[model samples]
Target chain A: MKTKVYNKQAFIALQSILVKEITRYFRIWIQTLLPPAITMTLYFVIFGQLIGSRVGLMEGVSYMEYITPGIIMMSVITNSYSNVASSFYSAKFQRNVEELLVAPVPTLFILLGYVFGGVSRGMITGVIVTLVASQFVELQINNWAIVCFVVILTSMMFATAGLVNAVFAKSFDDISIIPTFVLTPLTYLGGVFYSIKMLPEFWQNVSLANPVLYMVNAFRYGFLGVSDIPIENAIALIIFFIVGLFSIAYYLLAKGIGIRS
Target chain B: MKNKAIAISDLKKTYSNGFEALKGISFEVAEGDFIALLGPNGAGKSTTIGVICSLVNKTAGSVSVFGHSIDQHLEAAKRCIGLVPQEFNFSQFETCQQIVVNQAGYYGVPRHIALERAEVVLKQLDLWDKKDSQARMLSGGMKRRLMIARALMHEPKILILDEPTAGVDIEIRRTMWTFLRELNEQGTTIVLTTHYLEEAEQLCRNIAIIDHGTIVENTSMKDLLSRLDIETFILDVDSVPNELPKLENVEYRIRDESTIEIDVPKEKALNQVFESLTEKGIRVLSMRNKSNRLEELFVQLTERAQVVDREQKNEN
Candidate 1:
């Protein structure tokens, strides 16, 4: 009975944090939900339609179809990463994160609450972008299970990574530095616009070192039934990152880094 | 032996920069006791509260809430405390109602129950009318009350408030005092730290004064005040006297033709001073304490502690 009550309270605490996070982003839909949809639509028009026609038949499918999954994955990654980073950092900046810190809620629950909130935004944005992509190109699902698993895992991975960024962030400038300098560069260099098979052997090997490459390729394999790298290898690498980042984020919270004195 | 609501022993906190906020301070607050943890600025009052709330890590110490050690039963210890920090810590963008309800949710209160409790607390705090307004839009007093309302939503066993009425108007401060008094009457233990010594003197049954990162005095309010050897009163006279009246065991100073400052010992009575003034043809129109009685004692005690500290440093 005691454990049951504890679990129920923990669940309630998690729900509260998640609801606050969701409400915050939705409250400013123009800033959060709308921008990604508009950005992805622009990507579809420019890269998928205008540019794909000139550079076609790179993969077995049309260029439009080949990049659709990668585009969706990109939206998921960016939105998930930014959502937790900005929201958590804002909470810290405002000093309101003390609400959770002073509560009886477990640190793990707080961590999961923020992560799930990010995942919710990421998944929502991913679906919106996917819908926009469908208007421009017909999307085929070769493996529904893999697509679901990859998207969820990838969203979780980036969301946890966003929390780590928030834990170490001392200023608003610190929050944006990672996304601009590291995340944006890595996402573009990942297999989003082109497959690694088109690259030289040395360049391909170096590209393989990028974790985003595995996530994008795995997501693409789910939709196109073809990938430059093995699907199992991509899945393994994504899982490895999720565990490592989750542990690091949880440790930061437990140690009260950046938030507590 | 009353049950201990909070027991902190040898609580020491040395910040990374080597500033010692708390230096082996130990104290206990009995259950249902309204205690004032008094201190000047940077006297470790907030730091001690921070450690109890688990908001700041202590370098070395043990804190327990109702027998639950913070190191072992952290969640249990946290569940027992509701803290109203000195600063406005609620999100400025959220509505008052949301802030209160969300705080309740953090303590595992169901949404429905939290809504009901929020209504009760917000209204009790006179913030029901402003519940829908964003927190930033509320007046300073209302914001402070909102934080109090949020802290009370969980119905914590002990409510610790740090300077809850710093900049509040007298009317609002009075109402808050009444509200807090009623809260204490209902068996809720309260620990308050305030620069308003009058507020502390009026609201708290016990007093603990800290200075230089250490507890200097810990005693009941009545006992501490009883230890005051002298009380200074400012007397307003109807007419000026060329020479001040000389009375035994009473020191008098002429501030101006119409006012005189007198220091009366505890054993002396005001009637004796009045009779002497009457004999001297000085009509006393009004009299008031030169300062808050508690404030005078607080200053004296802290200054004494500082002198001791300086002496020890010299010896070292």
Candidate 2:
């Protein structure tokens, strides 16, 4: 019969969900945190050591250094997307999502709790990939603020996107389809390997349409002080996507779209 | 004036598939009252609970808890409710203690308080020893108790249990009944939907029988039972009468050599039948109601609803 103030209740609820999510993946660190590290290590070994030795500089830097930001960005995007999509979908599938739905927590806090959890995983994986990259290439951060902003925003953007995916997802298979068909292609073609300028005019325009391109290039600018696009434009697009996706997520949650029915 | 723990009016639910699961139903539960919301499967009991808890969108209706409207004061309304859903809805991998504590945290209980409440409820539910075990590892009965323990963590004023004892063994079910009685005695308003009529008859002071998305009867247990026109009793006899006893306003049949079934209408007196049998030198050893009184009323009401439904369909 005791009721806390609204803000306090929301804070506690959000913290609980975040803690639950963190504990879940942390308990299975071998599966959640370890795989990305090993995968990024392989990427550094093959792309940075073996392939960069054969290929010359493309973006005014060695192929290894040029792809480092893209690789790290790739891991962050995938980790953020997969973390929310899989985790939320699992909650739905297992029906434990009802716990939050029945509680006094607002929909906004519930959405944020899941997103922050994804962001945490994304940040952790990004750091792991960075460490793995530093083993092969000399690393230097050009703009600390931009780097932090880009990585966090990029993670939030994808985590929000993952939440949207999870809201519409009907099954476990639905959760994976977007990451595989849509996300993988977008990340790879987002110019993780080669500069978009090297492509033909029509392909360059197509690459420009890929939002991941802006994120990767912006992140590249943060690390190497070089980018294929303007930093301001990249930041603008990231903000735009985050706002758009978050609005959609909030609306879906408010409507009780998938989680409620 | 005493406050109502829950007040629902004109509740209706139309699924996305156009199934009108709940027509329009209105009911209220008084504070500190233990009530049974009895209905067959698909009778809208779960949907009603779902709407109160905001798990399902209501197509039309209003539900308020302790005078807090769900729409205008959702958090306040939700703060007063604890829902134990019919299914095992907790994360299977979570430890028993973690499940309860996390649920408390969702209600804004601090980590320390949540942890303390978790231990207390888990121990009270006899799940403390299994606090560290994964939820999936517990037996079905223990899992059910875990749900109760989780729901009780925040200690809401009103607890709605949706078939909490389904699939549980009789012994555990009775123990849960006792626990719930204790909780209700301490002033927790309990509204339980149960398929077991005996549990309802034994535990709840009030009853509501819902049929075909409508409430056919909502009254105190005494009033509901008083509405029964006839009750059958099974009597153990020391000696079998070759001919069944003849009594006015009563039907009699022999079940076997030692047992007899007697259908007693409200107009008939039990002592009259005993006196008539005693004059004939037949002594009754024992007697028991052939069925729980609530079960008999529930069947009659539901069947009557079906008949009315069929008649309406034919007219249409």
Candidate 3:
């Protein structure tokens, strides 16, 4: 069929995917975004108000503000990670990914599709929870650009990571195991509720091994202009992981790792 | 490269598990060719399409689409080949039009051009009415048509369909086939993998039968049927007389508990048999060739192959 052509349809397709991704989480907001906000509120009540009364604060900021950045970062981390993981996994499960895979779409655009899907959900939940945290404590957004940068970049990073997870994952259990056995513990001990300075010198040194620590502290710096870890390293490492994860995702997809077979 | 729209040269695929799926398969589909890739399940049909589309990485051999080596110029090669996978695989959340337009984008068609192509392709496939419908909301046959529409969005030179009408009803399938033939007439080389041999017999001018991960037979349709030399015919009469009548080049066998199989050779005419039957006034029952020769030939070859395989297994 010598059909008439619409040059702007690429924008339409991208718009369609973004709309679909947004709608997917919105339709299931009860499960995707709302729960994390609730979980963080609980953390605010128990960990910040109750635990801070006894543990005190660090870096001259109240424990509430200090932990707020980490909690918000944690939300971005989990939401982005799980959104891509489950969404892509579901596509694999339902055989829908095959549709896009066979198309002439570039590997990057396809990766961007699923990765940005995770970004949208992560940021949506991150913002909502940030609002919720404001009801409890005095908040400061020292650098809005950095705050948005880290949120979006971290979201992109974890979303790509989640896409890789979806590629290798075989079943539903495979999808959940990472969040439980790997992500949850990493986020919690990642200094989400306490400063690394609270840890003994040896443990504090060991805490550097956690990638989430850098992300959380970097995000905290974005909020209050302070960080236990070097902010430059935080920014560089995020870019590093984003590039790294995006490449791995591109490889797996181009290789048709799980979907084609 | 020589007016060949699609050429698969010694294509082989061996999985990481060491199970060979395509054992050096070789064939060429000329421009505007309608070739049927015929096989039973687990016979490497999907593998062939997957390899051509660059979805299933090949362990050996090479494939070229419209003279561009997929290995050397993947994007250019892939741009010429559009594959409609057998399974329902589009994102359920996407409307039918979105799926088709997105596929166009992969080929570097801009969004405006993609939508225009998407609209025409969708309408041609009888899916324009369902353009805005979510893929999951459509019926099975409509979804299958949607897939075909999506594949055509880029106006690919070579279109590969994996069982394009496997689950659809006969009427709808026929409708799809008609549209496909029109598309094929417009100079798109169509490669189809199908289980329905009768459909293969009707639509494909050339046929390739794959068995046990190998191209067992590949030939033009006329040549393939002429190769089916076992001739069959039917005699119609009131009933068979107790006394039997012998006719040249005709072999008989009882069928349906009362009917009989009559096989005739090329040298003999039905009139001779009719005269012989009338000479005895033997009441004959209704008769016709059991079916086209391909079915019997396919059965004969595969059965013989299986028997040989079994004997070899026993010896091993």
Candidate 4:
């Protein structure tokens, strides 16, 4: 169906866009790749060793192991969202989005190219964070499919959201606003360090409202076979959000909301 | 009928802030035509080019490239066009080779083909030695050439250059003109927008001049140039004439003892002036136009458009 929608030119155009996006961050790995690895390392040390030890067992597993999936998911979400948000905003700022707009590339391919760039960064950083976590915790992989599915889907979801943020963003400060005020708080409160069961009933209901909770818990379920919500429900939520966010991103692009004018 | 390289019918664009940049403009470029789209600043030249490339959304009307409607067959329409925008839109961090190769890839050129094409175009543009250098490291003239190189990599049927030599040095500008002339000779349809009337005069066969978001003139270059009523020419004489001889319907002003400027009407004959000058024993050494004809015409049209604007405002 994708091929039917896009001819050979569009396909090649997509590849070119993807290659450019990939090379951009890779060329500056110290800025894009290294920062997250170092930050996640500090998180593992400070939260898992210093504070997580006193916090003790969560769901009958060691605190470090219980929070491992959540921390990794956090990095994936942040990196995926930030990569696209910053990259796309910078393109808009420099007016080079015109290059993509003027090309024969389909709108879907353009969106996919940028989203995949975010996904690539998210997955790479996710892997590095996972490796960092493995050093401190006896990690177990209960369902690899669910792990891969959840990881990819979460990255896609956040990447799409970041694109939407970029479409509406007018300045560099605007790009950072959502990630700081909304993303950071939602991610931290998404049951990363502790399970929602530790919260009172009212707060647990509040935590359930956060979409990121579904992603982190789904990822945690893949690794430990334990989850607050049904695995099927978490999986469905992730898919639903991915579809919804992708549609929104496509609509914004088609309408030429911010970039075209 | 021959295929049109570009066709725009009633194209319109109004920004979200209520700025009407293009107000229902329409024109066409035939295949292989080197046409100049000339206008003063803010006369919607860039907006028109932007709409053709899909960089700006059109509020109404339609555009087609080689029979492919931009609205329905945008990809096909875009495949036929290579646009060099007025600004440096490529990433400053990208190398010249990367920028050009990446542009070729956008048009569906394979990686190897894009690489070869990049080398060829860069070399042709005298930019091969700086291929690996970042774009920001290049001089302004080199940056402008780099944009042209990138645009030509895919070899689109139509190339739209918006002020390709705005701030370039005269030498580089002449080199670019020569290069563009050769490209035009190879049957590439070029539609350029520039403030330099001399560029339009030198390189274009047809021209469409816009003023206040409307086309005031669109015709063949020869037809446009023929519309001038009088042309001023400076004559260098071999002898210093104490008194200048004037012919009927010809106005002459002596610049120096041996140099004189004369305004020759379109209906006047040059031989009459030569006869009169020869009678005075003032032998002519050389003669040339006192100013660029196109520049004079452009100033007249823009000034006339401003008068109309003033009258409309007064009526309002």
lDDT of 2 at B12: 93
True-structure RMSD, every candidate: 1.8, 2.7, 4.4, 2.6
- Candidate 1, A90-168: lDDT as tens digits: 9999999999999999888999999999999999999999989989988899999999999999999999999999989
Count clashing residue pairs per candidate: 0, 0, 17, 0
Worst 10 residues of 2 chain A by lDDT: A1-10
Model 3, global lDDT? 0.83
lDDT scores in order: 0.94, 0.92, 0.83, 0.91
lDDT value for model 4: 0.91
The residue-by-residue lDDT of candidate 3 on B1-316, one tens digit each, is 2389878888889898898888899888889989998877888889999988877888889898888898887766877887888888888877898778766766667778888888788878889999989988999999999988888877889899999998899999899889888889998899998877777888888988887777778888888887765687655556666655687657765554445567777667778877777787766666677776777777776677567768977999
Q: Write the per-residue lDDT of candidate 3 for residues A1-261, one digit (tens) a residue.
A: 776343443444455566557777887889997898899899899988998767666688888878999998898899999999998899889886766666555566778888888998998888899998998898988999989988899999999999999999999999999999999998998988777988999999998988898899889888999888999998898899888888899998887889875
Model 1: DockQ against the native? 0.88
**CAPRI classification of candidate 3:** acceptable
The lDDT leader among the candidates is 1
Tell the DockQ for candidate 4. Answer: 0.72
lDDT of 2 by residue, B194-262 (tens): 999999989999998888889988999989888888989999999888876678988888899999898
Q: Which candidate is the best by DockQ?
A: 1
Across B9-40, the per-residue lDDT of candidate 4 in tens digits comes to 98888888898887788889999999999999
Residue A121 miss distance in model 4 (angstroms): 0.5
DockQ of each: 0.88, 0.83, 0.40, 0.72
